[model samples]
Target: MNLISKLILGGLITASLHANAMIIRHDVSDGKYIQQAADYPAIFPLKDDGKTKNCVGTLLTPQWAITAAHCTILLEPDSQLEIAGNKAKVHSIHLPPEYGYMKAIKNEQGKIIDIEDKVKDASFDIALLRLSHPLKGVQTFPLLEQKVNVNQTIEVMGWGDFGNGLEGVSRKERVNDRQLRVAHNKIDAINGNYLIFNFDAPDSKNALPLEGINGPGDSGSPALIKLPNGYFVAGISSGGDYPGVQTHKREGKYGWQEYYININAMTAWIAETMALSITKN
Candidate 1:
């Protein structure tokens, strides 16, 4: 892939790079999540290295990008999410109004003890970014106007690692092996504020053979819907649950439930934020 030529087709459905990092792995080790890369300029890869956090971001317009709120923080005025051999300097960030952060309370052993208190509103995990420069050439995706109907097929892409198994791996391990991968699944449920997609594994006899599902480091991946008119951004990869009851456990049947920030629910916020970005410049 000639990197720069990686055009975001219509709305970033196809990958400019044939082979992207695997979004998720179902089988044990060496499992392949996605077969190819989603050759789209907006398909950003995520990497959270504590010192600096990384997450996927989609170019909605020349001057604006969208991503997950928890993917990163509002930097101290002058930093950017470096991605795709380029950097989109952060001009401003707009998070959901109801969103609030809870500091992680860690014990003497350094283990986070207050899981519940640190929980934020997962419903409005979406955030919009005003970039210092416009991503040239690639087609920017528009937010979906209508409500997402059930059974609607949606495409998701990210650079998540595969094969965390039931004992899902850590962000550091995933970042080491992450690749830009793409997969598709139908909307299984709607939570008013989210688009719930069920990503089944290849081993699941009765479920859809969706190759991959969102995993750690895929927080800001775009949930794209192919409308009759064109492709649109319907959801942002807010979070997901894997198979088995054990939380954060990797593997088992795909049975991954992915939650995306309902784009329609934040329509006004998106516009208001983008407009504000323009005013800033």
Candidate 2:
């Protein structure tokens, strides 16, 4: 099926299934180790009212943030899109170089015209957040031009609530808690515009089903893969599916994860944008 259909079906499957084990709450007394990764400094919580809404972003540059455009636009109403940090502000938004308007075929039926001219490159599914002020004490992670290989292990950290959906509480104690959660996974597939990863379920050795990993709150969180020298942003947490276990399937049969818009694919766009921003400033 298409990306949209996969997302909708995935959501339905996740909602109906409750056979998965509840995530255990570990001790909060110890320092959050997940928050210590290089990527965590740039990961910020995106909030709507006083509640922890979604993951915001870190300032890769004074003007740019690496995030999924689908999560930033489709999931967030225009008015509610605000950055959360020591200081929060919103400025202009930028998409990649090829992010101009495009048409989409709806199944075998008619075409869906530009629903919002603002979102043209949903296929790439990546967006850059421009902040009103330069983020203090934040550093951009290096971008990799080469493709990451399958079976290569990577670490992902995010403020995504540990439980199930929006109503689930965060794994951390405080809403703003910079506490990070680290999970390991390997690359499963490399599509033209996305990358798939296979990770184990919470406390389970078996791999999660297709399109299941970090849930909704992890929408824009970066997947960090280790390199010989350091780490690179491999993928963004896009979406997942969690169907219940059945006799026909194994115990961990229903956990899978799919991430759209791998950062390496947009290296040129990222370099170009930074260069332009530097010149303008």
Summed backbone clashes in each candidate are 19, 11
List ranges where model 1 is wrong by over 4 Å.
1-38, 46-53, 74-76, 82-86, 102-120, 164-178, 201-206, 228-230, 242-248, 251-253
Q: How well is each residue in 15-97 modelled by candidate 2, as lDDT tens digits?
A: 21111111211322223324443445555555443434354454465446667654443332232333333464555556665
True lDDT of residue 179, candidate 1: 45
Q: State the lDDT of candidate 1 residue by residue for 180-202, as single tens digits.
A: 55666777788777887765655
Residue 22's C-alpha lDDT in candidate 2?
18
Task: Name the lDDT value of residue 26 in candidate 2.
Answer: 33
**Which candidate number would show the highest TM-score if scored against the true structure?**
1
TM-score, each model? 0.71, 0.62
lDDT of candidates 1 onward, in order: 0.58, 0.49
What TM value does model 2 have?
A: 0.62
Off by over 4 Å in 2: 5-39, 74-85, 97-121, 164-179, 200-212, 241-253, 277-281
Candidate 1 yields a Cα-based lDDT of 0.58
